[model samples]
Target: MAKKVLLRVYGMTCDDCVAHVKNGLEKIGKNVDVSLDGNAVLDIDNDFDPYKIPSLDVFNGRYKAQVKEIKDD
Candidate 1:
C-alpha cells in the first residue's frame, strides 16, 4: 500500500540545497514518489532504505514527518 507523508526540512538556504534534497530522495528508488516546495513529501509504498541516503545532517535542518494525503493509483 502507498501512503503520502510530509517532511519539514530546514537549512535549505539555496536552490542547490533543494536539488541536493531531490537527488537524495530520488536515489532511494524508482518505486517511491517525492516532492519538495520547502519541505518534502514522500509517498511511500513500503519501508524505505535509510542507508541509501547520506546523512541529511549535512543539510543542517529539522526533519519532521506526518501522514498528509493518500491517493489511489
Candidate 2:
C-alpha cells in the first residue's frame, strides 16, 4: 500500500517555490506533486509516516512546508 501525504504549505508565491518544495520532498518520498496554491501531495511507502517527517524549508529557507493531512491509498 501507498500513502498520500497532503501538505498545506505557506510562503510559496511562485513557480520556483513549487520546484523547491518538490525537490525537497523527492528525497523523502518516491513521488512528489506540488501546487502553486500552497499545497503538496507526496506518495510514499505505506510503512513511512508523513507526520514524522521534518519541516521543509527549501530554496535557502524562503519557504516552509507543513503537513495538513494524511491519507492511506
Candidate 3:
C-alpha cells in the first residue's frame, strides 16, 4: 500500500531550502514536490511511520516538518 501525504514545512527561506527539504523527504518517500511557500507533497509507503518524519536535521535544524494530511493512494 501507498499513502499520499501533505506536509507543512517551516523555515524555508529560499530555493536552496526547498532543495534541502526535497532531498531530505526523498529518503522517506517518492514523487517529492517541495515549495518555498512552506508546503510539500509526496507518496510514502504505508508502513512509513508519520511520527518519524525527520526534523530535517540534515540542514542543521534549519527546517521543521509536520504532517498536514495523509490518504490512501
Candidate 4:
C-alpha cells in the first residue's frame, strides 16, 4: 500500500530551501513533489507514517514541516 500526503512547510525562503526540502523528502521516498508556495505532496510507502515527517532538522534546522492531509492509495 501507498499513501498520498500533503505537507505544509515553513521557513523556506528560496530555491535552495526548496532543494533542501526535496532532498530530505527523497530520503524517505522517491515520489515527492515540492512547490515554491511551501506545499508538498508525497507518495510514500504504507509504513511511512506521516506524523513522523521531519522538521527543520532535515534541512539544517532552517525549516519546519507539518502534515496537512493524507489518504490511502
Which candidate should be chosen as best, given lDDT against the real structure?
3
Candidate 2 yields a Cα-based lDDT of: 0.76
**Least accurate 10 contiguous residues by lDDT in model 3:** 51-60
Each model's lDDT comes to 0.48, 0.76, 0.83, 0.82
Compute each candidate's TM-score over C-alphas.
0.51, 0.78, 0.88, 0.87
For 1-73, candidate 2 gives per-residue lDDT tens digits of: 3888888777788898788778888877866889999878888887777776545436347776677888888
lDDT of 1 by residue, 1-73 (tens): 3444455555565767666666665554334433445656554455653332334443434432333444433
Query: Model 1 residue 7 lDDT?
Result: 51
Runs of candidate 1 with Cα error greater than 4 angstroms are 29-37, 49-73
Q: Residue 47 in model 4: shift from native, Å?
A: 1.1
Sorting all predicted structures by lDDT, with the top scorer first, yields 3, 4, 2, 1
Sliding window of 10 residues with minimal summed lDDT for model 4: 54-63
* Tens-digit per-residue lDDT, 6-71, candidate 3: 988888999988998898888888999999999899898988876567554553587888889888
Ranking by TM-score: 3, 4, 2, 1
Better of 1 and 2 by TM-score: 2
